[model samples]
Target: MFFQAGASMVENQNADAILLAGTDLGLAFDGHDPGYRVIDALALHVAALTDLATSGRG
Candidate 1:
């Protein structure tokens, strides 16, 4: 499976974390465990935007 391959790559490369920036990539690692730390770039962007939009709210 892709997850296994990814996990293997992570282990091989000794990556601290994986960046899932693309929508499809995000979909691939969203609910499944990939045996490593994964950062959803889209989620972080959305969170930042949401916080900015709501920052002025009372």
Candidate 2:
């Protein structure tokens, strides 16, 4: 279902990827591919934090 919707949006808008806001929505894409690119905003934020932490850059 998610894939279909995303596909439609991609086709209609020529989008390269899908943006998913909200912190808890990662569960939907976990261990599964939606047949297109779907980026979880929360995950990207966390990953940026993790990288900063590891790099010792405040």
Candidate 3:
């Protein structure tokens, strides 16, 4: 699930997420460029997954 906002040259589709390699830019740069919206979305998704996992519905 790798989302690159500008990497695609197509005009009709887009990526939903991105999985960058640790060796590409190190952990310090992880998600830093995505800013708060991306972080918040990820947090919400994580929280929902956690809830589902804890409830044995995942």
**Predicted structure with the largest TM-score when compared to the true one:** 1
After TM-score superposition, the amount by which residue 23's alpha carbon in candidate 3 deviates from its true location, in angstroms, is 17
Can you rank all candidates by lDDT, best first? 2, 1, 3
Task: State TM-scores per candidate.
Answer: 0.78, 0.74, 0.33
Writing each residue's lDDT as its tens digit, candidate 1 over 1-58 gives: 7677668768898878878778788887778877788889989988888998899862
- In angstroms, give how far residue 52 of model 2 lies from its true place: 1.8
Residue 50 of model 3, lDDT score: 94
After TM-score superposition, the amount by which residue 21's alpha carbon in candidate 3 deviates from its true location, in angstroms, is 19
Q: What lDDT score goes with residue 57 in model 1?
A: 64
Across 6-49, the per-residue lDDT of candidate 3 in tens digits comes to: 23412235444443433443344454664312334444556899
Clash count for candidate 1 is 0
Which pairs of residues have clashing backbones in candidate 3? 1-17, 2-17, 2-18, 3-17, 3-18
Note the clash tally of each candidate: 0, 0, 5
Give the winner by lDDT.
2
RMSD of each: 2.7, 1.7, 6.9
Model 3 poorest 10 in a row by lDDT: 1-10
